[model samples]
Target: MSIRLTPLGRMVVPVLVLVGLIGLNGWLSATMGRGPWLDVDKVFHLAIGIVVSWVFYYLLRQKHDAVPHYGFFGAGMMLGASGWFPLVSQGLLFSALPDWDITLFGIGSHRNPAFHSALIPFFLVIGLLHYRGMRDFAIGLSVGVCSHLLVDLCQSASSHPDWYRPNFYPIVRGMYGPFAVLWMLGNALIAAGLAYGAAGRQPALVRMEREGFE
Candidate 1:
């Protein structure tokens, strides 16, 4: 699971895993319930998180040697987990991060919008991660946030009744296609933008070294 591969191979594995899992989930729902069962949201989220983390990781690694070699990596190797563990674990951990609002902040509804409303703390974490030389991990977590918000923000009030309430975020209730999709995409784009900014920044040491060279 922790094996490194050629770039093409590394990219292909996640897609394959996503496809296979989706198929398996579909099969399970078909046989177990015997009727319509489209409840593989978390699986899709997990795959999105893993795949997007890789996307950001690859982009960040292109110009920065500070980023790790994809497998058996930690923010600074402290996690010590190997293979796909680094990315996969991050994907799983951060994708569900937004849901913590339910218990921690006493939010009555699931997938509450209050989490993203607070931008100051998110910015603080970004700064701290940059200082710790873990901006790549920050990018990974951003991808997960994007994934969570993409799904949660896309649902219609008709589907998720809790969305009926007045909340911290805008509610674009629809049939889960046009308006909802566009709204979700808009939020996700901002998350992607944040990740892009993180990837574009160089570590202080790296920046100083480049200046010295120049």
Candidate 2:
């Protein structure tokens, strides 16, 4: 007895799994309330990290024709790089990187403008320009970091209205209000557009048939 999934199923399964995980997290958050181990912020960060990484994978996969074909190994490598591992690791690291100044130099608050600023991504883009080979990986890391900051900003606004400023420290300070919600929606729209564009670009079964793998 063998089971086969259609191309649509292949895509839908991962989405369904993600939704299920999110639902579980919500349930846990509601039941557990606030605790050191089950902090809402931590769970939210992990969930967003995973989802963003998955989206990044599809985005990179969309340009199948443009990039080199490493086949199964490439797919696995991308998964490991963008999925929970690098996304969560790099995302958490970059997000916290900004706070180090507080402990080390005691110059500014934890949410320093230098690290959390939107300009950070532009700098990352410049790095990619100079180092072309690391484009995909760099993009994945940047997305992770940016997404983390966006979520943190939203959380900070909702939880601590007094300190809801979104700008980097000492530069300009203003409330984010509902901008984070809009930003999340924008991210979803971008992911959907990428997936729609890549939908039938190169079905694996078709490739298998052509390559005599079936």
Candidate 3:
């Protein structure tokens, strides 16, 4: 089925993606380094971001326009935006919020809720627009958000010692300096990979298969 984007949906997806890109850029400036933000993390994030979007589009190739192009794009953008929220929020509050005063149940990263909240609505709208019911929407939302969060948690807790700081409550920390830049680079690449996987032709096909089952 040939898919098309509703005008409003078209506008929304790109705008959200652009905003997400901008936020990451700002975060790179603040956290990575002081000199013109020559951090590799930003480069990785941008590259991965594009790759994720492209890969997602690719995987859905069979469904080319099935999910409604803009709808898929919007869903992807929502995840992207949400993925960066924690970093952006922390950057914003880094100086303002005391090290000992930040928690809504002591979640380590700000990115968690920021992305998940936005993701649910994004997928919900995608479902509504496609006249697809709640199942695909929920799956998409859960997969997108949970997948991203799982990566973050894993990176933070295990593989990426340099990317984030290990601490309990009130003071969640991430690394700084060159190593920090590398950490962001790694995370961004991983995010992009997940996005690509979810949004990819295979994933989209899986979604379509699930839809058929329902």
- Residue 3, model 3: Cα distance from true site in angstroms: 26
lDDT of 3: 0.40
Task: List the candidates ranked by TM-score, beginning with the highest.
Answer: 1, 2, 3
Name every residue pair that clashes in candidate 2. 113-168, 113-169
Error of 2 at 127 (Å): 2.3
TM-score of each: 0.54, 0.48, 0.33
RMSD of each: 8.3, 9.0, 11.7
List, residue by residue over 1-214, the lDDT tens digit for candidate 2.
9889776876787678767765775677678765533355455555665565565555556555433223432332233222333223223322233333454555435445454443443454445432323433334444545445555555455456644245322221232434444444354344333323333233553465477764
Q: Model-by-model lDDT, in order?
A: 0.49, 0.45, 0.40
lDDT of 3 by residue, 106-202 (tens): 4455433333233343445445432343333332433344334333343344434443433322111444434443443444444434433434333
Displacement of residue 140 (Cα, Å) in model 2 is 1.9
Report the lDDT of model 3 for residue 161. Answer: 49
lDDT of 1 by residue, 103-127 (tens): 4655455434445422422563367
Instruction: Tell me how far candidate 3 lies from the true structure as C-alpha RMSD in angstroms.
Output: 11.7
Model 2 worst lDDT run, 10 consecutive residues = 168-177
